[model samples]
Target: MTAPRRPGPAPALDLAALVADPQTRIIVCCGSGGVGKTTTSAALALAAAEAGRQVVVLTIDPARRLAQSLGLVELDNEPRVVETPGSPGELSAMMLDMKRTFDDVVSAHSTPERAEVIFANPFYQALSSSFAGTQEYMAMEKLGQLRASERWDLIIVDTPPSRSALDFLDAPNRMSRFLDGTMIRLLTAPARAGGRAGVRIVGAGFAIFTRIISKILGGQLLNDISAFVSALDTMFGGFRERATATYELLRQPGTSFVVVAAPEPDALREASYFVDRLSTEGMPLAGLVINRTHPPATTALSATRAEAAAEAVAEAGGKGAKLAAGALRVHAERMTLATREQRLADRFTSAHPEVKVRTVPAAAGDVHDLEGLRTMGEALLAAEDDTGTGTPRSRVLPLRPQAG
Candidate 1:
């Protein structure tokens, strides 16, 4: 009988190559919330710039940490240069402003008078600011604008940290549906056909629909919605066409996706789903980054050994014995934590053996500066010898599942 093949470490993702390659014009970092997606995106852009590639990193998340890390007070729709030492190339970063981007799209596609009308509409104001899928749609629109400008050699996108990693991917389709849906067509019918004649073409159901909408939204709000839809009807086709083009852009050769996750069950599960979804949609997936991984200690002492040693020191009760016991106890706790983290990572690898992965060790504290981002970039490439002597004493180990 043939034996089952044992699971092994996944192929290492060459982060340096991914960032340094000139052909890679776009890199998207996507994952669940709190998985360090923003930091990873910044680090990659910083690394690419230092490697002599002009890079612009865009964050869809509204978090302020990205701005603070880059030593900037704030970030807006326009890119801001990050002044980091030893950066041979250039790096710029920006945060998406959904409303502003929508207005920009309107200004670009419509005549000055029409754009003014659209902008002044109350419904347009609400849709631009808080409508469902607005953020994702605006992110896509901004990306399209950046690509068309060809100002940067590479663009790194930090997708929104929503619960579903697919939110960004599904944005274009969702927006298109909302624009072309039955309700929108009905609302705009009267405006398109000129006066009440358009309402007669829409039949009896239109009357009932408008009546119900009027009851909920009042006459003024319904008129605002109708006027908004009528003015936007001409631009709807352009909106969908651009969205489709951007969706195709994501599937192009120059684009690559990096799935970021923490060394935990929930994060890894989400990463797995992202990997599968990318594959199903024929999107080019580069690999995964297991961030905040705990590296094992180099000392000969194991968790069991450290615990035993601590107990012995406590029992002996000699001078400095209490200090030694406390130190040993701390060591024991760290060792246990490192072991548990490794096991979780190991499980992820076992499930997705074909996917390449790079592990980034957990830092002592939060990354809050350009220098810290540079260090993170090095860790992502596995080229940092943080332990001194130009080499690390130990590497992060694979995590195993815990017993119930």
Candidate 2:
């Protein structure tokens, strides 16, 4: 029988290598909820600092618990400094506030009078504050700001836990539904176009729909929507331009997107879909970071023997022995899963030889501070040195010019 072998601890990571790579400018961390993506972003920044690069880490909708980890009280657009130990590198972080970003954009684009009118309009207000794609747009906006900054050398972004990771990937176009679409005019038929067949039909439909809506929220609501749309009539093209620019920025040679996922089947599947989606859009596919990998207890035959002995003890009714064996079994199972992870990773490695691969083991506690970030950086950087002795590393990264 093949003896179970313990997997060695991953070697120290070389964060400096990733950031310093000529083609890499951005590192985006994405995964399902509760997968430690937020922590990963911070850790990369800390690691990058050790490598001697100035890093700015950004997060959208970070949990309160993790906000504590990143040394932030709450979400804000402004960046805060993060302390990195045993390194002279600089790091910063921010939690995105989508509503704030919208308000800022509106304030920038319109007169105070027009801004208030739009802000007070329920429909316009809802679109800005409660809309689905607001987070994505705001994230893009934040990236734009970071890219323009002279303070940092790198930007690490963590996306919200979304049903479709592509949501952020496609957000700019989706949010401006009214701009490119003629459906709204069709839906809100006016009495002016009476002679045309299509106008007449639309008017009749509008009459019935208006009456129903009038009874529910009153006609005032529709008036507000119309007014808001009119005031913001010129904003659509600009919004599209901004979104396109951000999308192009992602594809630049300097921006490197790190697709984050776990070893679990669903997360792995999501990672694959994201890869396919980015590839289809011609986005830069920098590399992949697999988190929460299980550590193996032994190597080769020793691991197999431990598993067998553990199973034998359980079969022999040695409850105490079984418990001891269970730990080894868990480790064995993780390594088994790790092998599967390796296979999937290998698939990518073989196909995209230029893309770098980084793996981080599951940490004991959730990361919440600069110190915790340093620990994560250490874990992420572990595989570079099997002997558990390596210096922290950071790399100076640049923003790929916004895509034209």
Candidate 3:
């Protein structure tokens, strides 16, 4: 057996090269909620499009930020071409509408008569709209559809803001289990078997089981579920197959997973979980993005020295003393924050030393337009410093001018 690979310092993630490559077809941005996955996805798409690659970004996030940034009044289930002036290539975007996508799948796969029946079923309505895991499953379905269209050179996916970042990856298996499960088989048995054989197949135990479930779910609801199961029976295998295909698409060579996180402990912990899960699932992890870092504008002054200087200036009580002291104190606080962020980052790197990382400094305000997204994209692809300073370009600051 081969020896285990040893961990080493993480190489800088060259996002520019990754997006520029024609072979890189799909990039999935995933992390815990509120880590800027949507922005990151949009920025990556913008970068690739400006680089002359046709791109479409699918956002599972419900927020209107992506649409706003792209200059669209709104986004829906269908892809809308974005007007990117001066860009050689094209860009399009869409938000996932789980219910509509589910309807499309049913309508596409079933006869009109059957489709209407399934659409009318109460169980189908509930499952398609608010069912657990439905969003994730629909995301997979939409992604598969986009890939089959062959309409774009690159696809960027911003995964849903779910409780767990791995929900997107688990969607296929969850769908498969639900479709082929014993519970579903039992639910549809009466419709499939019919008449006396159906009753015989169900027997006394099943009859009692159904009665208990009926009491809990109400007879009408139980009947609706049984009807829904029977109507969807023919399409069950199709759902499982499609989900499997999409899952495989994610693991393909052309696909890449980018874990987005903040410098905070909780966010980094979630990133670590995502990284570990991606490794376990054999997914191709491109790298990790530490977003919205508070890097100090200058590293020449240490926090201790800044605090000492502030105290000395306050004691001197000379001209501009209060203002100078306040400025130094502010710098001291900033330095302290930067130190904490770097310490947290180092902790993460020490654990997963082989994972590449790219840090994006926090913007002064929210990015709400194409130009802002372009700026964010440039920061993502900034060159890394190699002078043993352990500082990313986004985190580096010019030295302060010396006194005359």
Candidate 2 wrongly placed segments (more than 4 Å) = 1-15, 21-23, 85-87, 175-177, 183-218, 308-356, 382-404
Put down candidate 3 lDDT per residue, 149-192, tens digits, no spaces. 99998999988665454686788789778877877878876666
Model 3 stretches astray by more than 4 angstroms: 1-9, 194-209, 317-320, 386-390, 394-404
C-alpha RMSD in Å of predicted model 1 compared with the true structure: 3.9
- TM-scores, each model vs. reference: 0.89, 0.76, 0.90
Candidate 3 structure, TM-score to reference: 0.90
Best by TM-score: 3
Better of 1 and 3 by TM-score: 3
Best-to-worst ranking by lDDT: 3, 1, 2
lDDT string for model 1 (1-404, tens) is: 66655456577778788898999999999998888989999989888999999999999888888998888999999999999778789999999999999999999889999999999999999999998788878888999999999999899998877655456677778877888788897887656665576467675777888898899989899989888888888988888888889989999999999999988889888998899899988999999898897665544578899999999999999999999999998888877887776677667778888788887878789999998998898888654244532223122553233433
What is the C-alpha lDDT profile of model 2 across 1-404, one tens digit per residue? 66543222223235556766534568877767666777777777777777777878788754655457767676467888765557777777777888788888888878899899888888877877777777787788778878876578788887776545457767676756655566456444453356689776877787777787678877887777667777776565777778778888888878766677776667766776777777888887656677876545433434467678778778887548768778768766765665666556545444455545566777777666777777777767654434231211110011113433
RMSD (Å) of each candidate, 1 decimal: 3.9, 8.7, 5.2
* Clashes in predicted model 1: 5
